[model samples]
Target: MSGSEIVGDIAEGALLARAVEPAAGEAPDGHTQETACLNCGTTLCGSHCHSCGQAAHVHKTLAAFFHDLLHGVFHFEGKIWRTLPLLVWRPGLLTREYIDGRRASYVSPIALFLFVVFLTFALFNLAVGPIHVEPSAVIAAKSGGVQAEADAARELATTEARLARARRGAADRRSGKRTGVRS
Candidate 1:
């Protein structure tokens, strides 16, 4: 760090302010200390490395990490908006278009299934927290009926069975329906 070298660095920083070419890894967004690609030795010309597709400035902060986690999950380059309606209303058309090599505009079927599965389990866990099995007598009393606890127990068993089947995975539900169709 001589004074002359400090002036040179200041001049380069000033170049960014002007209409001239900015330094490597210095985009309009943020300045990166990286001059060359971390993954490949190629000089970065943009926010993403031109040679390899890795981002020039990888965020190492905790906030950045969480932001990436959320963005990666939720933001599929705004393709979800194009994907969901077709998937729901015109599934055959969606599948045909995807298989016909027009996939970049929509989320792939496998990716949609995976995201739905993750969301389903996350929401199911949140909704079903801890299971509390109360005694049958309480249920009959709550109903204000004079029926025996045995009748209450049977009703509870039937309701529990329905809930158990409802909680099964999508594949399991489909298979169960197929089995029913076959029989």
Candidate 2:
């Protein structure tokens, strides 16, 4: 048979074998059996169980999905808090130290940067609301600069009107009530 036909035959054979031996350690949905903790052999409860710290997780479980989501979101599982102060005070000391290969002891700089960014965004959302904005835009929008400008224009108009009235009074004095000019 041709290579394509041979490959197709092999795939059919494998599918037949899978259908025949469905319970040979495969879940109905194709998931493999869950493994217990290596150290304690107890069925792990979740990612790092309370009993033996075994990660009782499969890639497809709802709980595992949520666990990963929460881990990504909160991010301070332990390392973020430890590294932040050092990052702020020491500056490139972190980048330098990490680059030197003394790695196993701290959060990765990328991870730390992500954590800070997530924290800043979370705090910003909590403080502001659903709407996203720059602080400068928000401040500029709230400030009364437009109203102030309008007030200034009104004031200029008022001053001009007052100056006109004063000029009219002076003209009346000059023409009608004249100071006697004896040449």
Candidate 3:
């Protein structure tokens, strides 16, 4: 048989199997099933709906949730492998291909962005511990308290005086006034 005919046969067989098998979300006790799509009321054929593409199985188990998380991070149908090189080295080409609708071969930009951001945050948190600020009391305890306060006050006054002089200089320049000092 030709390739197209073979594919058609497989599809027909799948549909027949779906018809014969118990629908999803059924308990198999001869009662009506709630397997109908919540989004569009179509019978789901597999894990996802053929009508609306929403997931047919909404897993409530913790194991299933972790499985989905790992699958999303690591599986992703090898699209990340294809997208990363173009994203890092040839971003313009990536943008062009996505804009031109040649997208089946690579991850979508939004998906890639989200994945990258998640990966970045995960790695950052793993590598760097949370920042802890030393309170002023702790800092004062470390440095001699009275001396540290006096030094900080002196530095602040010096900084304020410098800033005031700079502001006066700028105002003088803007008003086209010159100090009486010779060049």
Candidate 4:
């Protein structure tokens, strides 16, 4: 496929993302000591701001940052665990419940659809890799004859050396070494 088509496909997948919500007053462990929200200057009566709807706690630590990042990227804030089984066994009920506005308790239908689509693509990508091919004749046309053969031999040797070094590194890690063994 053309580069534009490939990019368009990726963009289609990218559009429906970022479903996971943060741990708010609605969710558990949303306690905040501060009296005012960091955003909008709203008086904090609860764990989240009423005016801007930002979390009042506003975690600054590295762990919380990663937690939020994971949640944001994968929608792993406990909704997928609840949504998927129901989507499989009782799809009609799940659809009805989502339409009836019981959406907060499960992943949204669109988000779940996008997740499953990308997951299928990921499994295929890992198993099969890139689908296109550049012909050997094209390579020979670019470099030609004896020089091409020498270049190919040199490239093969370099690749084999890298593979051997990687294997040695893997063996070192498996043997509980602090560092990889140098070639």
Query: How high is each candidate's TM-score?
Result: 0.33, 0.31, 0.36, 0.34
What value of lDDT does candidate 3 attain over all alpha carbons?
A: 0.69
Q: State the displacement of the C-alpha of residue 32, model 3, in Å, after optimal TM-score superposition.
A: 34
lDDT of 2 by residue, 56-108 (tens): 43334555546655655555466566567777898587667555433333565
Tens digit of per-residue lDDT, candidate 4, span 2-71: 9999999878654543233343334345443667766456687887778766567755445675665455
Per-residue alpha-carbon lDDT of model 1 for 24-70, expressed as tens digits? 33555554456777656678787777875656675544566576556
lDDT of each: 0.68, 0.63, 0.69, 0.69
Q: Deviation in angstroms for 151 in model 4?
A: 46
| RMSD to native, candidate 1 | 20.3
| Better model by TM-score: candidate 1 vs candidate 2 | 1
Give lDDT for model 2.
0.63
| Candidate 1 local distance difference test against the native | 0.68
* Model 2 misplaced stretches (Cα beyond 4 Å): 1-77, 132-183
Residue 66 in model 2: lDDT = 65
Candidate 1, position 43, lDDT: 84
lDDT tens digits by residue: candidate 3, 1-183:
899999999899878876877463354443333466654667867765686564554443456657656655654686788888998999999888756435555765555666889989999888996767779868778778778899999999999999998888888877889966333
lDDT of 2 at 146: 83
